[model samples]
Target: MTTDTTALRLYFPISARASATRFWHRLSAPALAHHLINAARRSGIQQAVLHPIQSGYLKGEKLTHHHPEVTSMRHPQCVELIDSESALRKFLHDHAAELHKVRAVLLKCEIPLIPNRQAG
Candidate 1:
């Protein structure tokens, strides 16, 4: 039996904005999720939580992990780095504007079979 316990959805735009004035049309939630699931399956993760990314900051979750949601888009410059630590630093240098969306949703894992823990 495959032991599938952890259920955390990971979502984010593929081409995260590198600047306030740049938005890539290649970014799509469905496409990104499809690729992610395929990669996970290939790596032997039998099951995984899936949801659309809502919002986030430099490191990971926004506002001390207790704010309102989890995950976020890659800041423009960070997107440029792809997998470099330097890219992350760029995000830290510019996180204010990218993290100011009011209509962002708290991404639900696989349609929410279980209710999420309420923020305290």
Candidate 2:
């Protein structure tokens, strides 16, 4: 069976930090990614994945890669989520505040489902 699906990809800096509120409360890169993943799970998203890139750069930034000599630097990270179009739309709307801080792309596509056969 083929069904409609939407792929949501969120891109951000791996070492970037975000403020949670007006106060000093902040979230590290890992923490922010985890928070978003948890939110996706709670929102009934079918799948959510976090990918750490070894070398890459975002818009208006210089490319960076992992080096043994360097101890700290910013790298690109991506969070991918797949689900129904409506479900993803709702998720984006619900998490607009947090999502606005990152770059996001939504792609519409169809997913084919294959059934399993039992051995006799």
The 10-residue segment with the lowest total lDDT in model 1:
75-84
Best by lDDT: 2
lDDT scores in order: 0.35, 0.78
Q: How well is each residue in 48-117 modelled by candidate 1, as lDDT tens digits? A: 3443323344344343221244322342111111212332333323443543421222222234456668
Any runs in candidate 2 off by more than 4 Å, and if so which?
18-30, 67-73, 111-120
Report the error of model 2 at residue 47, Å: 0.7
Q: State the lDDT of candidate 2 residue by residue for 20-88, as single tens digits.
A: 653445432345677788889999999999986778888887888856677234567788999988888
RMSD value for candidate 1: 14.9
Tell me the deviation in Å of residue 20 in model 2: 3.1
- Model 2: how far residue 108 lies from native, Å: 1.8
Against the true structure, what is each candidate's TM-score? Answer: 0.26, 0.75
Q: What's the residue-level lDDT of 53 in candidate 1?
A: 29
Q: Model 2, residue 114: what's the lDDT?
A: 70
